[model samples]
Target: MTVEPSVLSAVDAGVATLTLNRPKSINALDHPMVTAMDELLRGWAAERDVNAVVLVGAGERGLCAGGDIVAIHRDASALSGSNAGDDEAAACASALFWADEYRLNADIARYPKPYIAIMDGIVMGGGVGISAHANTRVVTDRTRLAMPEVGIGFVPDVGGTHLLARVPDNLGVYAGLTATHLSGADALALGLADHFVAADDLDAFLRTVGETGPADALAKYAQEPPESAVEGRRDWIRDAFAADTVAEIIERCRAVGTEEADKTAASIAAKSPTALAVTLRSLRDEKPTLAETLQREYRVSLRSLLHPDMAEGIRAQVIDKDRTPSWRHAEHRDVPTAEVDAYFAPLPDDLELTINAAPQEDSSV
Candidate 1:
């Protein structure tokens, strides 16, 4: 019998590297992988010999697609039928997964040593959680970043609400609701990424890090990114997404009467109404700390797990391979205010998120 490691960790020249090893799945995060990473990072954070840490994916396709929602879907499906014992077991498994994953995210945000994430390819949802919190985020021409949880009948988790709330203007709302793909240039323009290195120059850039350390090496290879697709549309994004609610945003977009506005409206229409409504509220928190937002998101995640739309959305998108999802509410306005409010309510002390400490403020980045 043989066992395969989900994460590959190594140290060379005082630099520690963690590679997400499931290339075939675009390094999608499962419970074991998340637990392994959390343990490794905590150990490395306290090690005197480890000067810096680097995170990257094994394949060229992606850094990480997101959490292993397929596994979650399976667990969610087991809640019914004639097995009461299975139901209890599945519920416990699901709760532990979210609890541990959120804790790990908070740890990365407060890491004592320099943490660098080589965000080369697809970075979305849980992927964003791991890399975006790092001290140094490196993006390349191939980077494709988004937080498209609404499409799956889920609000953005893994501290996504925290990061989205901080993006300039109402662009965060636009990105969260519409699930728009941001190129490397777009990510840099939006402050979601730091350095932009061409894909071809990545190996040379990494070798330079091995020779002269990350800061100096990254500075050498970092170049101005190409013009951003998102930056050009900032005016329309601000105007259309500034509304207080998802329904109002869609109305504003329709009123604009432009091709882009119509397309934006169409995209919003396709997502889960309940998820979109909750996402809008989540991103509207008044400049919350990462811990504060994660606590709120933890509540929403558990509530959404029990919601019917989540399972239906997953079935339509993943199992059936159909783009059309049958959301619980047909329109954003159909989602009751009380239902949206329920997601924000506090959980019991046992289930609430607890960070080790406040993240150290760094203005130098």
Candidate 2:
């Protein structure tokens, strides 16, 4: 059997369309996929007659579930019980992949043309990286978006800290710590998405967007979204997440003594203790630009790769399909302040985040 290309592209009616073809894995983006995407977008950026670029997934389930953690799991697992010489061999596969992926994200943000992303269904982690950064983002009622990396022993990357940092009243801290899902309206209220269109009108809307243009089609089809969950609960979120530490935040959640607040506390409790500490710190930092934020995230992510939680979290969550993860610390307060601070330490020049970074030939595996 022949394998299909992970991404398929075409130009029509003054529009360039790119369809993510990996429906089986919900278009889980991998290294080659992102590399190919960067190449395509770079060419399209200057091409004539391509007034706009549109991104869509091939299937009904969603835009994308996330990155290929199975591959990252393979790379991270190799680090366990290995010698010093084995460190690069074990870790650089996924590190190289992220280097390219984050660059692609930066490109999308700076694209000259109107980059339109229709986030019609589930968009999580890496999925959010691609679409949420676009110049224009569209969502439907079926949309289910999240950045639930803390559960998997990772701090958010792909400018996730930047985006979440922009959210009002420290709600981003709550969402990041809890690994919560946001509805279409919730996303809009938090400023992650742009317009809302009914699912029934999406087919016609796309065709019109190609034939007419984004502004006119959006004006023709976009409708008022329902009430926002985030907006309704802002006071409650602010009262808790404003605290300095995750422990105090959880205490405030319990002190509130409501169903939602109690559940929010439980969700934070379930994630890796070390991950929670790092994520909170990451969100609180003041990075003036996306590039600067991404540079700092590189340090945190590199440290996470060497930690045991990433592989173990993926093992229990995806590989074994189990719900339990054996984290390094059983409670958030058990993590040391110096250990959390070390995630921000500088790396050697070779591994620094650069303008153009790719894997070594052997890293293709």
Candidate 3:
């Protein structure tokens, strides 16, 4: 089979393994990577040689860190201008990227065949969207899972909001607000993963079950996934994060007055305050299908690029390697509802996606 430069695909024993090969950048998804993966998934659906697919990362460091935000920032910067003509052209280009990225994420969700994601390290934000909803999600000892869009002055995308909405109680809101990283064990407990095992045993487990193995045997194999230091904290997380808003959840954590809550609160307070506010609101707002939620997220992202916090957050956290962002909006309440509503504004019909199933409207999982 002809291989794409960004992705390495190999079919062995009817199990197709697609490894995200950009280890240098922790397999961060670029436009080319997204396009390549989407195209290959389409082809895989038709290939008789491939019965199952294992999505793995090339290195020990990460599965996919997130999108190539550095490239995204550079593109946005290059397109910025004072002239109306330049501004319009830039906006058009940005919108197209968002639409395509959102569509690709949707395809992964509804893709045929049993999809297994070997999430080894630093799965967050867009990474979560890529793997969270898969049939079998395997987490290793090194796994650090989170939806950290809030830190970057963005609400969760890649269907994170939709998945978060389905999680019980207000945990989704808490996760979105804090962008907290869940250990492999916690991921299983939170329904984000199927099982937990030792990182060292992952290779043997994969080989034992092989690709296209029986469902029952696969479940047994998952029971041996990697283990990490973070475990036995679910009760506290569920209790502290049970409220519907960040402020409420913070207050609950404060009420606990333990070091863990204190630490979590402090960690959250360090992120973009505006993003935390919007994330909570987004979590509590509505239930949409993966596609609809992605569309909404795209709208938020498109507007966020123009917002001061996005560039400032990236500058502090990435470009400068500093952790301080001077946000344009300091408080969530200070952000107008109209601004959030503007993100959901009707796009041109041609831009609307019709591929995925419509979302069922329900708050409860």
Instruction: Encode model 2's per-residue lDDT on 1-365: one tens digit a residue.
Output: 99889999999987999888899999989988898888878777767667899999889988988899998888767763354332373248888888888888877877778889999888988899899989999998888989989988989988888899888888788778987888888888888999998888989999999879999889999999999887887998998998888888888999999998999998898888888899999899874577777778777877787788888888989999788999999877899999898788877766678754321112121
On TM-score, the candidate that comes out on top is 2
**Superposing all C-alpha atoms, what RMSD in Å does each candidate have to the true structure?**
3.5, 4.9, 5.5
lDDT of 3 by residue, 116-191 (tens): 8888888876678778877778887788998888787767888888887777755566667777787887677566
Q: Give me the runs in candidate 2 sitting further than 4 Å from their true place.
A: 83-91, 356-365
lDDT of 1 by residue, 1-365 (tens): 87568899999898888999999999999889989998888888767777788999998799999988787776555542224332253255666787788888898988888888999989998999999888899999999999988888889989988888888877878889999888999888888889999999988988888778998888899999999988888888888888988899999999989898899999998899999999998888887888888788877887777677887778888889787777778778889999899888776666566766533323342
Clashing pairs in 1: none
The lDDT, on a scale of 0 to 1, for candidate 2 is: 0.84
Order of quality (TM-score)? 2, 1, 3
Model 2 TM-score on a 0 to 1 scale: 0.94
Clashing pairs in 3: 196-225, 197-224, 197-225, 197-226, 197-227, 198-225, 198-226
Whole-model lDDT per candidate: 0.84, 0.84, 0.70
Candidate 3 Cα errors over 4 Å, as ranges? 1-4, 75-95, 211-220, 224-245, 350-365
